[model samples]
Target chain A: MRLPNKTCAMGATIARINDGDTVMVGGFGVPGTPMTLIHALVAHGAKNLTIIKNDANEPGMGIDHLLRAGLVKRLITTHLGLNAHAIGLMNAGKIEVEFNAQGILAERIRAGGAGIGAILSDVGIDTELAQGKQIVEVEGKPHLVETALRADVALIHADRADPFGNLGYVATARNFNPVMAMAAKCVIVEAEAVVPLGALPADAVQTPGVFVDHVVALETLTEEYAVVER
Target chain B: MIARAALEIESGMTVNLGIGLPTKVIDHLPSHLEVCLHTENGMSGIGPTLPSDRADRNLIDAGGAYVSTVPGSAFFDSVTSFAMVRSGRLDLTMLGAFEVGANGDLANWKIPGKFSPGVGGGIELAQKARRVVVLTTHTDRAGKPKLKTECSLPLTARGCVARIFTDMAVIDVGPEGFELVETAQGVSSADVAAATGAPLRIPNTALPSF
Candidate 1:
């Protein structure tokens, strides 16, 4: 018995993403951002995108290009402190922005992958984040129901991958990628290195191949993937 | 203020230091002190911040500072990283705040039209940490008090702040409101009271200086 290969060209997979799609981009700053895939998405020119990412990468990098291209219509994220452009767009009402408590965002994505409808928590009960949320009384305490978030496509960056799409993410870069991979209908990954099926140890895999639909091996990591000067 | 706040952290506690002022507290901790430093970006046992030349592209704190991992450091996805925060595994979390109300209500994440960098992990850290302290300037740049009778800005969490370490004094949120814990050297209790927006409860004893 042989496992199927999921390797494919980046452009083709990204091309499948249509306008007005909800796309989950896995990253916490530069570490796990799929820069090459993002660039391909920019060239693919799908407009009115609702992007879910941790942060809008600093100016001229990552999703900023999509924002620059005026492709993003909405962004569901935890923070946008680092990107003035994103804030400007949000402030000007050019794009819609929904902020979540960081952990709740992760839990919502995880719940989506787990086939749950929502999870209750007290993270932001009395705050503005709870303004529109449905509250339920659980064991004498009020809990806000954070709905699960599922995306049409998820873009991931991995340190290593097997032809079967088993992924290994390095250090802090592992954040969001593994979970986002699980929460999307189509999970597309770009890896620093893609080796043979047995190359990545099974136990070391952060994202199993079954969650992935396509894996694109980076020929050379662009400067965007390097250690940021800031 | 940082050096004084460092005293709050005891050995064997897991601490999460917010991005700005609180992050500097790590530098003042004694070398012999052993605490597990957790970063919301999915690392615990955080090591020294590295120079860019020696930095690892894959490793960084939640603030995006290049950091190294200590011996027992472990990495997980965002879900598990936040699970530690929401589950109260974090012993102490020192956050930066725009305002702290007399009742321990914290306002930090949003300043409305002026500044609204959406709340990241702040709500969880403030709401779930075993002890939530704040490290901030006593006053804004315009010289208005940050320890307020009521927060004018939006709150990050309600009744979450335990203590506040400012440049002028150490204040605790007590049942009676902001109580003077200690004063900075050369700073008078009267001066602290004047700087505080809320009525300050100064004890009768001579206040210790940090």
Candidate 2:
């Protein structure tokens, strides 16, 4: 339960940037997210990063910044159509990614958190998503079964957090945070405000601080989904 | 029968009219009834019959196909719109029927011959809804009846249809059975049965002409 209040664009800020790392995202199309940590990652100058999330970030918010920054090289997500940057990079062969359906991505993240080996959902069966994935015959039929996932890092956003780092999701942004908390090796929280230990309610806590390794604070929340025209 | 069905359709009915013949129901509006159209992906208050001129690239149906946005329309997400459909909050949904047996099995989502984005949202919409109204031509092109003894195609939903409105006839699906409610202009009950691919029971005094 430590805070790493790193400034953007500082070379020392990027020492935490790791390669082949997976960041569990917390945002429903830019509504709720830790824009500071995300930009720090960009300033951190990481490359060949693998992102686990629902969709490719868009022009003004979410992971679209990363895609625009040309820092990320791969993504495991549901849709690439939304983020034109990611799609363009992929089309240009600058990045590689595995696209999944919305439900499949959610369940895979859940399976990883649940500590189960894998799930046998046939949502993407008999199609491209099944190409390299396992196909277990359940009563003599091919099922495009998905495997469990474990991330190297969980980068999440929290509504309120104590000094100890236990947190709650503000609203609909809570969709993936709880499940993602258990799916990663290291959890980093980027909170708008950081408070004293035990400041957050036990019932309100969605992702406990026991999982958080780092916390970055924002002076005040600002719209971070803006495209980096500069 | 048309008057009776009109009772179920109140003003401000937000409906998702299914593809094919059911798409024609927009024309059936009484001119006074306010029906707001919702296309999946996120559009409420869809415009009339989008063909070329009205095709708005920014506007799309819930299925992620481009559609025309009407004068007063709002676009959200395809997921949110479908949530409305699956949540059983839609007032009424008019669907196109391929086959509806005495058991009320549906087969509009798939043809089973080729790869279509089969059963995208049909299963959820047809399976659970407050009211289900189907629209189709009563007979097939070969003089075979589209209404069959059993669904030859894969079923989308089972035992959920309440009423059926076809070009040649109107029928009600009740606990009692397939009751003929109306015969379209210049169509007979006997001709309606003759066109059907299945054996149908016609209720007496219900030579409904809507």
Candidate 3:
């Protein structure tokens, strides 16, 4: 179904927090994500968010604010290398974190996009990985590794977006955003620049706005995040 | 020869075991030694076993899927997983091999008609681990031994593999060349030589049982 343009203006756009949530922030190490929306969620005081990301954004950066606010309950991410807030939270036993190998993490996102229930792998077999899990022996040897994952809401960043929710990303910003867009049930795209419908090029559009369910022009990205110790 | 190979594995060793032959070490490790398994995905201090149920359907190993937790298993996210490998927390990494150079460069990831699922922090393990072990079946499906001067498959890591353990012989990838450390119990060095595709260095020694 075609969606109407909803401004990402607080309660107007982001209505309520839902279960089985997955937000895909752009950039690898906390560069071009939708910081505005992340802060919005922090202000909105949402909880039980199951974030799907590449890295934990660093201090005074993207998701660090929410993590600091204690809003994120669970995280399914590739690396939590940068965010000190995450380290404190995990060490303190306040949050739940699930680890994913980089490439397999990407494939899990893609698997969700394709609507496949699970994908079998040979990556982690006969090791600590096969623990507490199924090891199907076929033809006198082990085969088929199955991982199940999917998402409900995908939050992304784009370079240019149309009112109808078509979107494009800039530079290395295309890392996990496009795949998350496909994997999510509702995609909310935050753009630096917003144009009318049909402005973004067909091929150049990394994540087609058609996948986007919400859009709003970000005012500016110059704010120095005021992170308070929780 | 078994003593020498056992020297390759010592007590309190943090081992990074590859699939295939390296997995056999689980059965052979001396009961007194404490060899922790540092898989690329996460989970350390692993014991030798697999549990029976999918209690946690979301938990996965390096490849990403539900895996049984061992007795002494501990869980952490990805950052610590890589840190354990990259920060010298692991003493040894028993790698797999597709091709091996005279100087011990190893390739084990890419294979024909098989999907490349993930690399899962192996590069760091190769670069940072104290000792590297290459464990693989001696020959391909066509009976050609995988030992070679250079790798033909996609390189997972470089300049790190030290020893080679196969179903045929336990060889060492030394600076000089592929040295035969030990052969399988039922096989001769000559039989291994005929089966292997590459020229190797084998000092006269009895085959060691793993």
Candidate 4:
């Protein structure tokens, strides 16, 4: 018995994304962002995308390309402080933006991956972020129910991977990648290096191959993955 | 102000410093201080900010600055990173504020149509840290007071701030509202009181200057 190879061409895998699909992009800043997959997505030309990410990256990078292409219709994110273009679009009503407390967003995605309905949290109970959210009393204390956030596809970046799709992320670059891998129906990964099966040590595997659908090895990293000057 | 705020961070405390002024408090910390600094983007035992030429592209703080990791550093996913915050493993968090009310309410994340960049991890950091202190200028660039009787802007959290370190003074929010703890050098209690939007309560004893 042999483990099947999950590695595929990036373009073909990204083509699985459709119009109006809810996509989860894994990254904090430049570190864990799947720039190759994102560029492939831009070339794939999927429109009306609902993007869930930590930040919008900066202008002329990452999801900003999708935003620039007018491919995204909505964004569910933690903050867009660095992206004035994203803010302008949201303010001008070109795109619908839903903000979440950073931790709550992580928990919601984790819940979705764990097959849970929602998690009750006290993090945003008294703030404007709690507005219109269902309030449930737990142990006589009020908590807001943050619903699980599952997506149609998850775009991931890994520092290393095996042909079996086992992943390893480095440093802070590990941010949303591991969890987002579990929450999507189709998990497509772009790895800096794709090692042979059995090459990745068992304990080093941050995300198991079972959670991933496709792994695309990056031949050359673009400047987008470089350390930001600002 | 940063030096004064850095004093509030005691040894062995787990601290998260918000972006902007609060992040600067790290520079004032003594080299031998035993503190574990956390970043919401997924790291603990955060080291110094790195120069771009020598930076590892993979390592960065929540504010997107390239940084290094200290000894005993650990990295995790966003969920576990925030779990430490919401679960109260964090000892203290210093945040920047747009407005801090007399009652300790914080308004920082949003200013409605004028500025709404969205709240990142600020809500949890403000509400769940064991102690929440603020580092801000005494007034906005327009010379308007930010320490207000009540926040006019949308709040990030209610009654969450414990102490405020501003350019003019170090004030604590108590049952009696903004109590003057220390005045900045060359600034008088009257100057701080006049700059504060809320009433400032001065003690009868001479206040120490930071």
* Top candidate, metric lDDT: 4
TM-score to true structure, per model? 0.99, 0.55, 0.53, 0.99
At residue B3, candidate 4 shows an lDDT of 92
- On DockQ, the stronger of 1 and 4 is 1
Q: What is the lDDT, from 0 to 100, of the residue B194 in candidate 3? A: 84
- List RMSD in Å for every model shown: 0.7, 9.8, 17.4, 0.7
Error of 2 at A55 (Å): 1.5
Local accuracy of candidate 2 as per-residue lDDT tens digits, B123-180? 5467555688877767655566777666776666677788877777777776755767
What's the residue-level lDDT of B186 in candidate 1? 97
Per-residue C-alpha lDDT of model 4 across residues B83-177, encoded as one tens digit per residue: 99999999999999999999999999998879999999999999999999999999999999999999999999999999999999999999989
Q: In candidate 2, list every pair of residues with a backbone clash.
A: A60-A225, A61-A225, A163-A196, B39-B62, B40-B61, B40-B62, B41-B62, B41-B78, B182-B208
- Each model's C-alpha lDDT? 0.94, 0.63, 0.63, 0.95
Q: How well is each residue in A10-66 modelled by candidate 1, as lDDT tens digits? A: 888999999999999999999999999999999999999999998898888899999
Identify the superior model by TM-score, candidate 3 or candidate 4.
Answer: 4
Provide i-RMS per model in Å. 0.5, 9.3, 14.6, 0.6
* Residue range with the least summed lDDT across 10 consecutive positions in model 1 chain A: A197-206
